[model samples]
Target: MTIHPPDRRDFARSVPVRLWDESFAADPLRHYQALRNQGPVGWGELAPGVPAYVVTDRRAALDVLHDEETFSHDPRAWEATVPDDSPVLGMMRWRPNALFADGAAHVRYRTTLIDVFDLVEPHDLRGRVHRAVRLLVGRIGPRGEADLVGDFAEPLMALVFNDLFGLPESQGDRLHSGVGKMMEGGDRATVGEAEYAQYVLDLIAAKTERRGDDLPSRLLDHPAGLTREEVTWQVFLTLGAGYGPTANLLSNTLSRILGNPLYYSTLTDGARPVMDAVVEVLHHETPLANYGIYYVRRPVAFHGVWLREAVPVVVSYGALGILAEREATERRHPNDASHLSWGAGAHACPVKQHTLLLVTEAIERLTQWLPDLDPVVPRDRLTWRPGPFHRSLTALPVRFSPRSPASEPSGVRS
Candidate 1:
């Protein structure tokens, strides 16, 4: 008897949340456009499941993300791809680490982070954020021009996480590398998950030895309890949560704002519109394109698609770009509609305030410092870094200068 080979139906069109694909690994927006053309929910060929619904439409994407009872964060399809000793899973299993768990668990886990997150809102950390931003811009001024990703974006973002975790400045590089690996999804190979994992292990050990009163120590000492592995996993999540996506936002927003330098004026003048612009930028580019979570509960039906119970659910952070673009076209208040970048429901990023504050602060400072910020390369000529999980720029080469070339450094006089 001859066996039939698998057909196109076997391939899942939507890629796994973090798996890097050449098509998207090279350009995130383009792939998002392609998926949008296929309609709100398309098949994810790269996904492990038999049928994966790719939600791109704004309302529909909102439906999936916000309605956890119907569309659980626990139903990500890529959990199988994660390593057996998955740091992602470690946090999910922990009590206060219940962001990955459903119902009672998610609520408990959220409480811990939400409390801290509420403290980091734009208003709450305004002084420190401005200071961090000014410090970053000042350093970039000496260089004249720099890759925002490396010099400007990374440092500014890493600063927030470091302060939040109370991790010393000395450990920045290690945490940065580990965050990169975590955001890469399946591309954990390049960063060496084992190495990153070991680093987290060491971080926990150091924190335990030092016995500090920061978030790490709190997780380690949670009354509900967590394992060393659990602390390590959350550390990875926390750092990644603060890094890649925000960096991507900086890179992408810089690209957009430089095209319109007037936003700088808006920010410097204390116009609320500037903050709205920054949030719009986050929604527009979608730094954390997708976030993968495991659904430990029952089945979920999104739209007409029926996802089986206990199925893994990967929540791509932003609505499909093309779909959002179209939705923006239809919006009465196109300026105010959030594009679902921070996600919508029970599992929406608990760190939304921290995330937005980082982006807003970075842009606000950079704009005020260098009103003449402009990309050296054209948009089409520029490239965006790719991965299923992150929509970042590999390198965002930019020139920074004063409003007047005569007043600014000769190096960045565009």
Candidate 2:
């Protein structure tokens, strides 16, 4: 059944709420809930003087995600309403990648990418993850103190991605650094983006001769007629999207295990499955908080809010996911995979299985290697990154008793 937009007259009565404020970045969940109380949709600035329509309503978010007809993933299709200088343009800019395409373009890009991912054997990926875990744990297990974010999760995820892409550790590190700077918009963003793009092109060029069972080779050899630029953008998107969330998942959940006594005991005692803990972390503290940007194709009203042509529509994923979690908690329900963590529709993340296996294995290995891990600082004292799109800690300093060499898990390569 087709869902038509609301009347324009209906939108005239509601006030646009501010969302790009510092308070929103610090504590988006609280602000989003307050916005929800105001109405289903509201206006906010994505960057200074750059207006966007923020959708906090669950049903409205789903509709926007699924309905690509009225909304477009391609920001270039929009009229020149947003200034070229807007910081958010860095994020919303058009790319030949699957992320910003629609219709046949989206299909072709997504098909090639998914086919490549399908080539990954789960057991092999798990082994790769374990190797990464083993390397990281071996480095820190003897120290008895570690910053989980810096010393473990980030580098471990980098190694896993390096394995997947057939890239050397040094090249992968540079790629990650460039991507991070680009995502962190400012004076450095333009240079970061250019350097990152150059790195991708160089990586793809290098991979053509050193072909193997890696993603870049698979995409390059796909039946689909993708341009070299398309292949590079797809790889960039995959690496950029995959690493941050996976690393955040590992660090955040590890923090929970170390800081929350009750939750830690439940996992260690085997009263709950480890997967259950992973699911709860996804539900309560979704790694990539706000994402899924869609521009209004034309002037339309949706869920009592007016969406003007070319205006950005931002989905509050963290807020909505936590709301779903609260509902489940109230009902005493088992963890459901329907949370908005992976997003909602055609544009949803395609590598759920890969992400899950990577995070799960990493967490399990950490817990087993350091059963007595605990936080170095109070839970409230831990710092978080000040951004609307990500929910990540600045650091996760933790301490643990050194495990004996004989106590290390079996099948973990030294």
Candidate 3:
């Protein structure tokens, strides 16, 4: 595995293809297939002079993910000459959180997070999901039309996480606004970032002074003995990672459940369960499409792609899904749990099961409440959020028969 120097022309030359382009976002499967056909690895511009190497091959992506010594998650290991004001810096730049750590620090941060998350029993989380869904559905059930992503999925996730973190309604609203602005990305993103940081710190301080059964208190009491800043960042990472991605998954999965005939029939006729639909969505349209931005530790090459020290290599999970589907019919188990959507190696998402359960319970309750739900617009009319990391819809509008406020079930408090 020899790593050659980067071609000067690679940066100077006009790139006819960009993975983050609107066309790719519109029809990613076609673009991913084209990339796969082109080669095992392809270079594209994330921004001008900002080159990223995308591994479309599953085996090559696995190699990149598992090769922690050679490929690091820490941006400090990067030697690339990116400017200070690079728009993607908020995402790729190093943070003290586990998402950007490597080696001993990664282990420490990850261990503390895992311990905190383990305190949340699965059954308890499920009950929270159920209650949150029922309450959310009750609010929108009176209206015949709704945007599932905005009106349902996002709020339900926020509510569940708010309970999990023991945050008051006021703080939760601030957290939601801050996170939403940050995700939108712009000059104002810094403002949102600062606001979110302050909120997290305040919450951590409160938990330390008045320890409770919430995740923050559990994190503060963890054996890792994390610092105040560490705890704050961990809380930010946990909530940010869990809620946004889970909501996106639910939105994407719900789209399929309503749009795909096979999936719709499964729900209507009870041939395939909603969980099965979720598995299918994970395989086909993973919420986090392309991520795992690991920086090259040293000059090395794998599968004929020259990776330089400091350059970011991304795992094309969306492309991997397309590859899986291309060969799905040949697989002995079509629904095997080997997809890279949750990522791979030591950096894999720890809350995968909880996220799946959250999605399952939300979809189950939603369909039960509104079984006749249908999309307000054709699936093709829907547009996706323009970003490199996530496959999210801006909104998911749907219509169903209106329910009377009187129909609210007994003791289901909103």
On lDDT, the candidate that comes out on top is 3
Task: Score every model by TM-score.
Answer: 0.77, 0.90, 0.90
Model 3 whole-model lDDT (C-alpha atoms): 0.76
By lDDT, the better pick of 2 and 3 is 3
Displacement of residue 319 (Cα, Å) in model 1 is: 3.7
TM-score of 1: 0.77
lDDT of 3 by residue, 1-414 (tens): 223335322322435346655777788887777666656676754544567777788778888778777888877755347876654565566778899988899999999888788878888988998888777777888888999988998888889998899886456567767766555444555666777778788888899899987999888888889887888888988887777778889998899889877787667554537787787777877877776788777756566656667767778888887687776665447777556888888999988888888898788767767778889878888888765667788888999999874575443333
| Candidates ranked, most accurate by lDDT first | 3, 2, 1
Cα lDDT tens digits for candidate 2, 92-125? 6888899998898898898998999999998899
Model 1 residue 288 lDDT score:
66
Question: Candidate 2's C-alpha lDDT?
Answer: 0.74
- The alpha-carbon deviation from the true structure for residue 163 of candidate 3, after best TM-score superposition, in angstroms, is 1.3
| lDDT, each prediction | 0.58, 0.74, 0.76
List the candidate 3 regions with Cα displacement exceeding 4 Å.
1-16, 77-80, 184-191, 268-272, 327-329, 405-414
- Candidate 3 has a TM-score of 0.90
| Sliding window of 10 residues with minimal summed lDDT for model 2 | 1-10
